[model samples]
Target: MFKFQLNAITAVKALVWTAVRRMEVKDVPTPTPQPGWVLMRVRYVGVCGSDVGGFLGKNELRRPPLIMGHEFTGVVEEVGPGVSKDLIGRLFAVNPIIGCGHCRYCRSGLKNLCLMRKIIGIDYPGAYAEYVAVPADNLYPVSDPVRGALAEPLATSMRAVRLSGAGLGDSVLVIGAGPVGALAVKLLSIGGVKDVTVIDINRNRLEWAGRWGASSTLSVTGDEALKSLRETHPEGFDAVIDAVGSEDTRGLAINAVRRGGRVIFVGLHDNEVTIPGNLIVRSEIEIKGSFSYTDEDFLKAVRVLESGLLDPREGWVDIRPLERGQETFEELAGTETKYVKVMFNPGG
Candidate 1:
């Protein structure tokens, strides 16, 4: 068993989201796990793009006075009633989605589609603190905290790639070149895709995408990039993933995909976008929205992390202490920031 000093601790430090564009470190009462739940000592918690949206007051699903974080990894510190003590000291990556067990979606292991689902960080208290209590079933054993923290985002990327139906020798275009887009490129490469093109306005992100298995990177934006893409690949790409769910990217994904090709929408940047419905009908282009991963996908992500197929310490990742949450959020909210992914060590 791992020896921890948590037993004597009654209060823990947490980064609380007080209002729009504001987060402060405060001492909060340590959570007591309910039956079938476990209290975990949070080690690493990733600041997702959605969390940035929450910080910018753009995400409607997130409200102020909430603990906003969904990607995290920790060690089991204490187990509640009916839980096994064997889980103590074990490192784990959390499946943040919680669903009603009796729902049809949950019964089929598609908890992401459950209508009454509650996410850890969004719905309940999250791991933006030194301790978090989550259901025992949501814990997946992991060896490394950093890699474990990546499992959630990787699962999202995996779901998008899987839904795109891109396979060996396929030509795929990934938009945004952000964390999810970069991860999609890596997955496509690992799945034997022949050509993976990543496009982004940020040249730095495009460069990182190239290193992350993108066959080519395009540092272009708006209609100019679209025209260039059309001129270069007149036949259009076999698959196009819109990882930046803005109006322009959505339209570009629709226009850039080949006839009958698949287009996967993975980003949540914009809720509403207008695309050419007539063109979609004429080309028979299949369009699908990829949401959070299913239980199976999350498990596969953990296994992939364990296999060392994805490196957690890539140049795109920035690690900081929890006290730096405000500055980190501000930096990420800015357009000129170079940080692609930031993870916080709450216990530091």
Candidate 2:
């Protein structure tokens, strides 16, 4: 397949003088799977907020001339030596994180926190292509390609709720209405949290939240958000999830949670944020930071999604062809749209 031309949307670096940023499709040679790896015929890929950030050069961890897509579904088209051939025709949702198995975190099943972790699309090539190679261990079989593309983000939401420890009848506040935040709200509701409030500056997103599982939706910005929160839940929520992760949202999470309540930071929109040390110390509030998902969380996400607990097809997700990745990324970064999430069909 060396002469076979395959197309990929790759983030190419412009000269230092130019402001141009965003990936473009290029015709490249199809990759052959190495030992322990399999080549996947890319089906669907999700455009994450971080993918937008990376395209805009906002994520310091991602370098240009990369293929930036972690959430994707595909069919195994070829298997390398030592791998089973039966996987060649099966569909899968690819887990993008490849952890060094010897790390302490990996041994504890917290591979998300592995010290020597390499993420697909960021550290290596990813599925924003006609075909890409991934380790066989990272692929999980699934039935639907669209829903399969959501496994990574759903696993992230699952990790956030697990870290928050919000229980039955607990009052929870989700601080964003984007895909992850919306999924958090839905999962919390499925976990039996009744009084869930979702806040965002976008009215359309807030509406989506309400439809998903939130009992209340607040469309507020800056200080007004805190005021609205106080007015609605005078005593504050039992747990606050900061899914936007801006300085303002961090502050809101700190002040909006009841004394002794938990606060989970799930968003990485901002590089750094300041919080009131005195408030956290005095209230004895528990503040936790959640990263990506563990293997267990990823598995649970697949099961929950398969059970139809939360379906992205119900109108929360939008699909576009992979060729439009640059335009879609620009649109998503340039302005806030009604779409809570957007997925790209790479096979098209």
Candidate 3:
């Protein structure tokens, strides 16, 4: 078999932006796969909020000079010895974090929380490059149901839904109707939740939420949402999901749920935040944090994607090439369209 090599692994990098503060883009090297790894040509990659944070310098110092993109899909062009022959030419989804299974986190079946986990696009090189090297184990061959590029985010949203503890007929509330939140809404609905209300300040985002299966979309402040909570369900919701990490949203979640309702926080803000713990103390609310996804969740995410349920075209995504990723992410913060997901198409 051919050991694939790219002519160049140019990447779109994020540099500081002062004016609109929408960062500039830089191109860097492709990469070479070493032993126990597979070489891929990125096909489709999702530009997630974390990627935006890096560009906006929210996650700046944590990792600058980093190739931005984690939720991605690609084709294996070459595989080193010890990798399965079935991988080459196969469409595959990459698991950014290939955990060290012996660690306590992994041992607890929580590989996503592994302290030494190798996070692609974070700790190591990622898909924004023309060529990316991933451990053989991180590659899952794509089938008809799920496309390779979309698997990562789907897995992420799936994990959030799974950890949410929201059951069927549960009234759910998702704040910040961003891309991930919208995806969560879809997952919650599919998981048998009877109602899922999404709140966002952006009118377009609120409208976009409807496509993601939001039972209702509201453009209300946290204080107002609380007031409505009284008339709607005084006890609060069965599950309240904070998709964006904002103190206001977090507080609303605390004050808006029933005493025993579950709250799942998935969004990531650069800084630390404080919440109403006293409310939690009195209500005995169940608060859980969700990050990334599990293998089982990944498989299920693939099933959902393969089921033809989510068509990004039908939804609100604008796909660009890898070269435009930085601009696209930065532009997203200012877009007037009803956009939720912005993707990159790294070509052959």
Best by TM-score: 1
Model 2 residue-pair collision total: 0
User: Model 3 — which ten-residue stretch has the worst lDDT?
Assistant: 12-21
By lDDT, the best candidate is: 1
Candidate 3 lDDT over 1-348, as tens digits, reads 222244444442322232223444455444567778887877777777777666666663336556656787778887777887788888778788778889888888778888877688877766666567788887776763125567777787778787778887788888877778888888887777868888887788778788657878788786787787667777789888888776788888788788888898887754567888888988899999998887777777777777777877675777776556546765765535467777767662
User: Per-residue CA lDDT of candidate 2, range 1-348, in tens?
Assistant: 112224343332111101337567775567677788888888888887777777777777778777778899999988989999999899999899999998889999988899888887778677777777888999888888888888999999999998999999799999988878988988888788989999887887888888878999888777898888899888889999988787889999999999999999988877877899999999999999999899999998888778777677777788887667767878777546778889877767
- Candidate that beats the other on TM-score, 1 or 2, i.e. the better one: 1
Per model, how many backbone clashes are there?
0, 0, 4
List the pairs of residues colliding in candidate 1.
none
1 or 2, greater by lDDT:
1
lDDT, residue 66, candidate 1: 79
State the weakest 10-residue window (summed lDDT) of model 1. 1-10
lDDT of 1 by residue, 75-161 (tens): 998898999999999999999999989989989989999999999988888999999989999999999999889999999999999
Residue 131 alpha-carbon offset, candidate 2, angstroms:
1.0
Give model 3's TM-score versus the native structure. Answer: 0.88
On a 0 to 100 scale, what is the lDDT of residue 69 in model 1? 81
Candidate 3: C-alpha lDDT: 0.73
**Better TM-score candidate (2, 3):** 2
The estimated TM-scores of all candidates read: 0.95, 0.92, 0.88
